[model samples]
Target: MAFTGIPFAALDFYEDLEADNSKVWWNAHKDVYDRSVKAPMAALAAVLEPEFGQAKLFRPYRDVRFSKDKTPYKAHQGAFVARGPSLGYYVQIDPAGLFVAGGFYGATTEGIARFREAVDTEVRGTELEGIVAAMQEAGFDIGGDQLKTKPRGYEADHPRIDLLRHKTLTVSRHFGSPPWLETPDAAVQVRDAWRNMAPLVEWAEQVLQ
Candidate 1:
């Protein structure tokens, strides 16, 4: 089926789930989830696949083996579009709203080493700084874990100290629960946000390569 849009019921489903996160409640409302939540997400993924590459929807079951909270199902639905193991675009839909993000959320050991090396180089480092600055100016939030102090080998007074301290790098934009979310415009908004972050995504891909 062609992508229409996410219905209001999807958001409503999440809100209800948050209030009653039990198997009984979920089983009763499974149809609502299938029609409103999962179906629309599949459609959204289908629509984005051509440009963003293959879409992979995450399973709703949470791995509670190592965690404290044992919530059976996730409160939100998320998906990623990628060509291979490389990071690409991501999307999330929940009660809060829609979130679109790109870039390496966390890199492999080799990827992290390459990323730091790129930041240590003058030309590539400056280019990354510009990309991040522009993304911030465009209203996207920069995200990732960072070291409180300088990294092991990096000096505290290093020029790209901030970038060098980052363990992972990513950019994301959030849209509050807007009326457009119930319509096809939600996909359009996500697409535009992804497009805006393309330069940063490309930069990361190049550096990691």
Candidate 2:
């Protein structure tokens, strides 16, 4: 797939990243960053629009101290598709996903607990369940290792034991897609994941709009 038509402006984020890493390879090849990331993402986004609506490009940033091979920049690009709800997915251009993460988190303990509660209570039976089940089936865990903690007012054996157990799917860009499916499996996986998240998206849209 080619990003033959994706405007260069949509991927202007790379130039900033290059400026930030002026002493590294990123500054030297600012022009190719899109070819490596934004372009692939554009290709995927084009194919996903019919099923997922318009996908927006997310800027790439360099995590200067993130790893041993930290090159002062990320080689892949990402974006969220918001047809009915907001959902995120990324495309890797480099040998990455050495570190990849996604999930819902609150700025404080109370907010986190409330988010967990909302998932278990109000949103349990809706699309969220499908998201959780699909993620689990895909071999990713949500909420990280914090799932073991109990809410401040909850008991150890509360029915919401598994109730408050909201989780997110984590996929390494390195892993080859599982069997079945045509096209890049990442988009398909994300679509199935989004299916269960439409309701929540709709709710948020109502509040924001």
Give the number of the best model, judged by TM-score: 1
TM-score of candidate 1 to 2 decimals = 0.94
- How close is every model to the real structure, measured as TM-score? 0.94, 0.54
Task: List candidate 2 segments past 4 Å from native.
Answer: 1-24, 63-71, 82-93, 97-114, 119-131, 143-148, 162-174, 177-209
Among residues 3 or more apart in sequence or in different chains, the pairs in candidate 2 whose N, CA or C atoms overlap within 3 Å are 127-196, 142-167, 142-168, 160-163
Model 1: per-residue Cα lDDT over 1-209, one tens digit each: 76677887888899999999889999999999989888989989888777777789998778889999988989999999862245788999898878889987777888888889999999999999999999999999998878899888788999899999887788998897888888888889888898988887888888776
lDDT (tens digit, per residue) of candidate 2 on 81-192: 6432222333332332212223332224544454555555544534455655655676654443345576556677765555454332232223332332223655555555
Clashing residue pair totals per candidate (backbone < 3 A): 0, 4
